[model samples]
Structure formats: C-alpha cells, structure tokens
Target: MKDAIEVQLIDTNIYKSKELWQPYRARGAFGGQSLHAYFLLAGNVDRPIIYTVERMRDGKSYATRMVKASQRGKTIFVCNCSFSTLEEGITLSHQVTMPTVANPESLPSDLDIFQKILRSTKSESKQFLLRAEKNINDNSLIDYRAVNQYSNEEIITGNVKTDAHGRRWFKTRGALNDDMKLHACIIAYASDSGLINVAATANGLSYNSESMGMMASLDHTMWFHAPARADDWLLYDIHSPRTNHGRGVAFGKIYSSDGTLVVTTAQEGIVRLTEAEQKKRRKQLEFENGFLGNCRCQL
Candidate 1:
C-alpha cells in the first residue's frame, strides 16, 4: 500500500486560467501559493526585485498594489492592484512584533514528522504517507518540517497561544533552472501548510478539537521586501493579530535565521464555531450569556 497526500487540481471554470492560477484541492491556488510567484515572475525580468503594496493614500485612491518583476538584475513585470475608497480621514498603523525563539536549523522538517505520525497512527494514513514520499523523493524544489508532532493520544487541541509562534524552515532542495519564478511558485505552494492553524492557536483553539468549526482563508496579501533564496532555509514566523466575531487575522514574517526579513504577509480567515458545539456552549452560558453579548460570530 502506498500513502499519498492528494494534490488534486480543481478544474472549475473560474480557475481555468493556468496563467494566473493552479487549482489545489487540499491547499489553494498554486500560483497564489506564495508571494514568491509574483516575485519570481517579476524577478525573471531585469528589474528591482522588491515589490511594494501601499494601502489607501488619498480619497482618490483606496489602495495601490504594485508588483515589479525583474530578472538579470533588471525590471520586467509591474502590476498595480487597485481598489476604490470613499473620501474619509482615517490613519492607522500597527503590526505585531516578531518573536524570537529556536532558529530554523534547530527545528525538524515537517514532512519527516508527518511520516513518523502517519506510520504510527492509521494504516490508510501510512499508505498516503508512502505515496507522498515517492512524489517528493525525486523533486527537491521545497523542504518542510512541522514544529510539534501531532498524535491521537495526545491530540493537541485548540488555537494555542504561546510566546513563540509555530515555526517551519523550508528551502529549495535542488538546483534551479534559472527561472526564479518556478521556485517562487513552489514556495507559494509550500507556504499554505499549517500557517492558518497557527492563527487559530491565538484563540486557544486547535484543529483537533471537534468544537472548532471550519476555518478558511478569505484573502491573502504579501510584500516581497527583499530577494529570497529558496535554496537556503527561510524561517516563517506567524502570529494572529486579532480574532473577533468568528474571524481571525494573521500576519507573518519570512526571514533568514540571521535576521534578514525577506517577506511579510497578511491573511484574513473565516473561523466559525460549529452549530452543535455553539448550542452546547450556549446552554452552559445561559446564566451569563448576556455578558458575552449574544455570542454572535462571523467567520
């Protein structure tokens, strides 16, 4: 029996454009997988590698999203993300500070840990593990490692809150073909693993808990501040900045173990408490239900 991690590509009409998207059933869009896709495409053209996204400057413009793709040290592709906003005076700026803990070299790979658990848990999971291993055994585009191992007995629960965020170290495992965007796209694909769960931890919620409802990412934005080398280990440190009314916001920093910040990301996800579980909790809170304000949630 062979273990496999399904990488099925969805062929919905909305996603037929391979030029802009790659359907990932378990994950999401493969092209939108990472900020690296945009960087790789832009980097291929001889231009400045840094792509900046400026949000809401004046009433005339709501947000300005700019992408500059470069290659051979020159500029190639530049795109502007546009939006409309009404005229109003509002200024706000705040971001979570990066956390310092075990460096990338100090951690294990996510795939190795996943395999260990698969073999230990269910026969089906084990078979899938074998298949996944075969799939990646030859291709060395990206490497993955899980921070803490998950199991049936222990069954880590809730969106946990800790001083150190969940950490993963990934890099290109093989040589590149000179098309930097391909590697970037691969990194985009790899970035989806376990990141959203890290945000759930903010509410003391873990995916293992049945009480936890479905969580899905609604939107993602990333800015490539500097060039990234997938061949080298890059540390992804993610944190949840806010969670209210069944929605959570997470932000992350992609850094070299040495402190070079190469990328930054912002993601909003819909987090909902299951109806059965919510009703169960509601009964227990009937006496003090008014305190939490109707227990309304929007995810």
Candidate 2:
C-alpha cells in the first residue's frame, strides 16, 4: 500500500506520482491515491501524473490545502483538505457503535477463499478465478476478510445478495511508521477499495457479473474522527441505502479492533446495467409514458 501510493516532491507545492498502481481491469489509477480531492477525471497509467498543491488557508487552529492532479495536460482530479491542531482540553465526544464482526484472525483471507473456489471450479471457469487469485496474490496490498462468507456457487455466478450491507476487516500487509499523516493517506487509499462495489452488491451484482455494465465512483468523502494505525486490523462496515437512476449511495464506518470509530466515509457512484437490461428498462419506460400520454389526451 505504501509503495502503491508513493509520491515525490518535484518542486515547491508540486508533487508527482513515483509509481502508478492500477487495479485489475480498472479504467484508470485507483481513487484512494488522490487522498482528499474530489475526482474530476480518471488519470491514465500510461502518463505521469502531476499534483500541484495550493495553500488555501493557514490559521492558528486550522489550515487548508487544495490539490489538483493533472495528466497529459488535462485536469484529472481535485481535492481540498483541511487540518486542525489537536485541542488540549477536549470534552464532548460520542460515536456510533461498531457492529459486531468476526475477528480477522478467525476469518479466512481473500486469497484463501479465491483459491478454494479455484480448486473446485471446472476448467472453463478456472480462467476467471485464476486471474482473480493471481491479482489477489500479486497486487493486493491489504489483508481483507469478509464478515459473511459466500458459497462457491454464489461466487462464480457473481450474484451474492446481502441486502446492501457488508462488513470486512482490512489493514496494510506491512507495518507503517508512526507518522499520522502517512497513516491517514493509507486510510484514504484503502477506503476507495471496493466501496463503489457495495452499490453493486446491493443489487446482487459483483464486479465479474455479466449484467454489470458500468460501476465507477462519482465522488468520495471521508472524515477522520480519531487517530488510528493503518497497519493494524480495522473493520469496515458499509451499506447502501438506495440505488436509483443508475446511481447508488453508500456510507461506511471504519473501526479499530478495540471498537473505536476512527473514520466515516460516504460515496456515490454510477451503477448501470448491461445494454440488454438497459434496453428492457427503456421499453418499459416508453410504455408507461405512452399510457400517461393517452390518459392526458382523453382528459
């Protein structure tokens, strides 16, 4: 994870990606690497990305910086981050209770799960599972374990419905230094992982589903409530409240192993069905509109 998000300071208030990491079959670079910026466009891995940071505001208690990322002379992403000094005498504090989940130690790793499926599947299905297994083994930087396990059938079919709720334990594979800023960046990078997929999971569609047309994060927002280590076990509890008009919204809470709510995240994204499904939807809409039009004419 640290290596995947590495950046170098090239000039004053300017940074460049040391190495770009793109997910398997992703259109562009991972969103989490952008840190606190709202993504305006997707940056291609073929080109180098340049980030220019502008000092927005600097005060005694608070500071703000705006980061703009560009690739190939096109603006790709933008974000504003605000920082505040820790208060000496803090009083009021409350947080939502973290949901109960299986301990990371007790749960099977994602690689193990994929390998199990790969062993049982036939030759025809092995191709996809093999690719998935290889990606998890080679590129995955975080150790992830899902709270609820899906069967091999469900995994192969790409239709695992869980009522729009998902919980998983995740943390960096290697120990990180004691720099809180770096940890926060790690959190930001990890947060974008599979978040938009929560919307697809709600509708019984996985990334490998044939019926899934397009799924991309439109915007992402996250808030840090307390200090936490990115290398330690953390539970991510997420759920999608609604999905409509090719859009879905999900909210997530990240909790430390000791049940401290350390981070909150909200994201909305485009969740579209395949072309065949979309055509059926369009026909249905046309029928309804035509019926309404006939009623108006009679009136």
Candidate 3:
C-alpha cells in the first residue's frame, strides 16, 4: 500500500503537476476550466502537496470552484474556475485553418526530442538527461508531435526556433477507459508543459533561456466548449500575446483532428531572465568545445 501510494503520487506529479490531489480532473467532473501548476523555487520535487476544494457557486448552467494547494503549511498555488454548460448561443464560423505540419506518425517521439537536448548539455547534466530519459521511457503517457521540427544542434548554437508559434499534437499514448473527465484532466496536464515556452520563444528567449534565472506559472485558466477524447490526436496551438515586467501571458486552443474546437486555455507566468546561470553554462560549454578541439587535432 505504501509503494502504491508513492507510485500514485509520482504519477500525479508527472501528469498533473500537482502531487496531492486531482484538481483539474475534479474540475472536469463538474465539467469546464483548468489549473495553473506551480514549480517550487525551493527546488523541492515531489514535495507533498495538500489541496482543498471549495464550491464557490453552483448554477443551472454554470458552476465554480476554488482550489488551494499547500506544502509544508505554505500555500503554493490557488485557482478559481468556473464551468458552463454548452449553450446554443451565437456560433462563429472557423476563420483560422489549422496550420499544417508534419504528421505525428512521421515525426520523432517526444522522448527523442528531449534526449537530443539532454545529450547536448554538459557532462554534469548527464545525470539529469539519464533520469529524464528513463522517465520518458517508463512513463511516456502522452504522445507529442510538433508542427515545426525541433533541432538540438541549434540549441547548442543558441539559434533554435522550433517555430514562430508553438504548435503540437498530443494524445494519450494509449486509450483511456472512455472517461471524458479523465481526458480533460490529461489535457490540463499537457497544457502546462510548454505554455511559457511559447512565450519565451516568441520573445527571442530560448526555451531553456541560457540567460535564465527563473520561470514559473502564475495562473492558469481554461474553458471547454465541446467534448474531446484525450486518447485521440488533438492539436494544441499556443501563442503569446505579450510579455513584459517579468511576466508572459499565453493562450491556447485545442482542436480535434476533425477540426472541431474542443478547449481553450490561458496562462500567465513569471519569467526572470538572469545572467548568472547564463555565465555558468557558457563557461561549461566553452570548456567542452576546447576539449573537443584538442581531441580532434591530436587524432
């Protein structure tokens, strides 16, 4: 039982970014909005989170919830969500076509993309790469394919621009048990993955931001317009409207393969770019380059 409990917590941390309870999934149980996940600046991973949910409002067609998450008696995150039943109100025609990209079947796995980035890092980062690779192999629950090709080479050169806008296809690696709530929760989990990266990328910052200091989710909100299956390929199209004063705001829309809009999400994150970490990585990279240069001449 202890082992199972630990595994469940790990699973929750990996998928939902919340280790205590399933918040967004619970939101889908009422059926509408999402969550903004928190990353502890204290660098504590797997810290037990305590979550409490309160019913804010209940209406015929709309419902609201307030969730608070804490660690060590310190409030880490809080979210207020409102859900509404689909109304037959004014419908708008699709004006934006899904940007065509290389198909999921044709693209590299998400694991491969991460492995490339890991390998590009310094030897001290090898352990992180190894751990990440293991995690990807063992628990790759989400399948991902990007509209733009990702290049690890460019990361080393600091010229990587996967795309002007962030676009990707994501679905459960395997089928779910026909639970729509579960699917929505999975999408909520996936939404947290790169919302800020879109912002950073748009603003000429690397996803890792070699000049990085810190970045974290401030708030997350979403609205569901129609039902969707997380097990089927759904496109996540994300873009950043503006970023300044150490904050970046991003918006996303999810569409089923058939072009039906399913969900929309909004998030704002606090991003502080610093030169300290940048200087550290640059020196390490320089050492690696010098070492490689010698190896080549000697051979």
Global lDDT scores for all candidate models:
0.52, 0.82, 0.64
RMSD of 2: 3.8
Q: Pick out the ten consecutive residues of candidate 2 with the lowest summed lDDT.
A: 31-40
Give the backbone clash total of model 2: 1
- The residue-by-residue lDDT of candidate 2 on 40-108, one tens digit each, is 787788777999999988989878888889988888888878787776786799998888777799999
Give the CA lDDT, 0 to 100, for residue 153 in model 1.
37
Candidate 1 deviates by what RMSD?
A: 12.4
Top lDDT model: 2
Regarding TM-score, does 1 or 3 come out ahead? 3
Arrange candidates, best lDDT first.
Answer: 2, 3, 1
Query: Runs in model 2 with CA error above 4 Å?
Result: 32-36, 130-134, 280-299
lDDT, candidate 1, 1-299, per-residue tens: 00011122333211112122222222322222223222222112121233333332334544444544333555433444544443358866354444566666666564555455555765444434454465335333457654554443333233344322566677765655555445454554456555666666666666545567777665566665555666667778777777778877777787765667766777676677889988987888885766456566421
Higher-lDDT candidate among 1 and 2?
A: 2
Using all chains and alpha carbons, the TM-scores for the candidates as numbered come to: 0.56, 0.89, 0.70
lDDT-wise, the better of 2 and 3 is 2
Clashing pairs in 3: none
TM-score of 3: 0.70
